[model samples]
Structures are given as C-alpha cells and as structure tokens.
Target: MAKISAAEVNKLRKATGAGMMDCKKALVEAEGDFDSAIEILRKKGQKVAAKRADRDSSEGAAIAVVNADANKGVVISLNCETDFVAKNDDFVALANDFAQLALNCTSKEELLAADYKGITVEEKL
Candidate 1:
C-alpha cells in the first residue's frame, strides 16, 4: 500500500470532516485515492455525521476530546430541549457517553444503535 502523507490526510479531513488519524488510515487503505478513502470513511460511518444532520437539535453544549498524546482532539455538541435539560445529570452523562461513541462512530444511526450502560443505543435515545 502507498504511504499516505500528512497533507493528503489533512485534505481528506477537510473534505470529509473526519479525524486526522482516521483520514490517514483511510487514505492508506485506499492506496492514497482521495475519493476511495472517502468511501472507506463513509463505510465506517465517519464520512457523514448524522448527529449534526438532525435539524431538530437547536440547543446544546459543546464537547471536545484530546488524544492520548494530547496533540490532537475532536469537538462536538449535544443539542437539548432547554438549559434545564442541559444541566440535568442524565443529559450531561448522555452527552459524555455519546462524545466517546462519536470517536468511533461515523453515522448518527450507528451511534444511536451503539451499546450504552446496559441498554441498546436505540433504547437510550
């Protein structure tokens, strides 16, 4: 496989909104083909973000994640019904859980279907 360069990975990240490492891996897996790498990310559910697509989310708090090396990070937001809901313990916990889930999830549906606590993602949502 061809080695993917940082510039190419950054380009893919800009185009797909995926993380740097994900983009790099996808690029390497696709032999440095930008569109193919994009397809790879999409299959992994990272190319398109489903949570961000929900137009119904009008209010929420933002979240971020720093890698183990603390050199890179990702940020996201959880939309809620109100400030009171945002302040609720359950809601805060849910947001934290989903943020971690997003690190591996690419689409909203898969994220919604992921395991959480003892319940299925669908049940939690």
Candidate 2:
C-alpha cells in the first residue's frame, strides 16, 4: 500500500469539509491518489444522502439577495434534518451564498444547474 501523508489528508479534508478520519480513510482506500480520494469521499456523501432521503427536512434557513444592478432578486431556502443544524452559522452562510447565486439566474432549473465552487449546485445538495 502507498504511504498516505498528513498533508494529503488535510488537503482532502479542507476541500471536502468531511471529518478528518473519513478523509484519511478515503486517502488510504484510494492508495494516495488525490482525485480518487475525492471521488471516494463524494460517493460516501452520496450514500449518506441516500440514507437520509426519508428524513424530514422541516428546519432550515431562508435567504434573499439582490443583484449588483438591483434589478433582480432571488430567495432560497436550505433545509436540514434538525433545528440545531438549521441554526448553525455555517448553514445560514451557505444559504446566503445560494441566494446570491440565484440572483444571477432566471429560473430554478438554471440555479440548480449553476456551478458552485467546483460542482453543480444540485450536486452540493
């Protein structure tokens, strides 16, 4: 097996916001290949999302943003499984970011299709 460095694990953790151990395990499973490790982590997130599909996402934050020109406005909601998660500062900030992204789009389809950081907004969900 290839050696996994702490730097590589930290890089993955920073990029994905996954737990440290989860990032390490992904790196180990990918045999130290960075991109493969990222893919593994993304797949794991997909599994978690699938498992949470039945969850009730009744708690969330709503945010609105106006374009620089002030002619267009958009509102977005980010839902979570629990009230604690909904109230988290990070969660609110993320919702605001989504709203900002939405301000530039014409339709819900376009907003979901928008690129966020690296992946599509839908993928981020």
Candidate 3:
C-alpha cells in the first residue's frame, strides 16, 4: 500500500470536515486517492451515526409553526451550544426549518444531510 502524506490528509479533513485521524485512516484505506478517501469517510460517518443512536440530543431548540391559511401547524427545536447563539437569527432560522422538516427527518442521520438555507446541517454545525 502507498503511504499517505500529512498534507493530503489535511486536505481531506478540510474538505470533509472529518477528524484528522479519520481523514488519515481514510486516505490510507483509499491508497491516498482524495476522492475515494472522501467516500470512505462519508461511509464511516454513517456507521458512526448508528452507534450514536442512544446518545441524548436534548440541547437543541424546539420550534413551532402555524400555517393559518392551510389550517396546519408545526413545531421544531434545534439544539445548539448556547441559548444566546440559539436566539440568533441564523440559529432560529435553522431551528424553524428543522421543525418544518421534522416530519421528513426519518433519522438523526437524515436530518444531518437535509438542507438548511443553502447548506447541509453538518456544514451549518
């Protein structure tokens, strides 16, 4: 197997938002191919998600919505690092959108991939 370089690992880490070690391992697994390493990290993220099923995600905000014209309503909350940040416009917007997508978010993993504003949930984080 070809040895991976640190610069290559860092590039993968930056592109995928994965941990340093994970990027390095993926690079090694993919034989230092950048694209393959990204795919490997993505798959690993899915595996990790299943393992985190039992973890608590009680720190997010709860948002509620009401569609008066349609006689429908919805509510959702997005967890974040702090209340102050939670109340910010961007955070509030995310929480609202997540709440609106609550019915569609089949799992935590799916929620992470769902688009919020212009970016994915992971990128927002």
Candidate 4:
C-alpha cells in the first residue's frame, strides 16, 4: 500500500471541501494518487446522490450576494435532506459560493448551465 501522508489528505480536503477522514479514505482507495482520489470521491458522491435521489431536500441555506458596486446581486438556495446538513458551515459556504457565481449569470438557465469545478451547476445540484 502507498503511504498516504497528512499533507496529501489535507491537500484533497482543501481542494474538495470534504472532511479529513473522507479525504484520507479517498486517498487510500486511490493508492495515493491525487486525481484518482478526487475521482473516487466524486463517484462516492454520485452513489450517495443516487441513493438519496428520492429524498426531499427542503432544508437549505439561502445565500445572497452583491457585486462590488452593490448594483448587481444574486440570491440562491442550496438544499439538503436534513437540518444537520443544511446547518453545516461548509454547506453554507458552498451556498454563498453559488450565489456569488450566480451574480455573473444573466439568467436561471445560464446559472444552471454554468461550469462549477469541472461540471455544471445543475449537475452539482
């Protein structure tokens, strides 16, 4: 087995906003390969999403942001299945990030189609 260092796990955590243990597990599963580790995490996410696809996600963080001029702004809701997930600091941060990105979009379709971390925002949803 490849020796996975704390630094590698930390790097994946920084890049993916995943928990330390999740990152470490992904790193170990991918045999310490960075890209493969990320892919592994992504697939895990897909599996989770598929499993919970039927669940209602009414709990969420509503984020609003304005541009530097205060003239342009966007409001977005990032939803999850539980209050625990919705209340998570990381989840709120992700919502804020999406609202900030929406500031650049001209329409809902544009926002949905926008690229987020190599995939569309709709895909992220």
Q: Which number leads on TM-score?
A: 2
Better of 2 and 3 by lDDT: 2
The C-alpha RMSD of each candidate to the native structure, in angstroms, is: 16.1, 1.4, 6.1, 2.7
lDDT scores of the candidates, listed in order? 0.75, 0.91, 0.75, 0.89
Please report the TM-score between candidate 4 and the true structure. Answer: 0.75
Candidate 2 per-residue lDDT, tens place, 41-82, comes to 999999999999998899999888788888888779899989
Better of 1 and 2 by TM-score: 2
Please, what are the lDDT tens digits per residue for candidate 1 over residues 1-125?
Answer: 89778889888998766799989998989999998998788777722445445545566778887667876655767776568877877677777777777677767787778887655566545
Work out the TM-score per prediction: 0.44, 0.91, 0.55, 0.75
Q: Quickly count the clashes in candidate 4.
A: 0
In what order do the candidates fall by TM-score, top score first? 2, 4, 3, 1
- Over 1-125, each residue of candidate 4 has an lDDT whose tens digit, in order, gives 88999999999999877789999999988999999998888888889889999989899999888999999988898888899999899889879878988999999999899998898888777
Better of 3 and 4 by TM-score: 4
Task: Please report, as a residue range, the 10-residue window in candidate 2 with the lowest summed lDDT.
Answer: 66-75
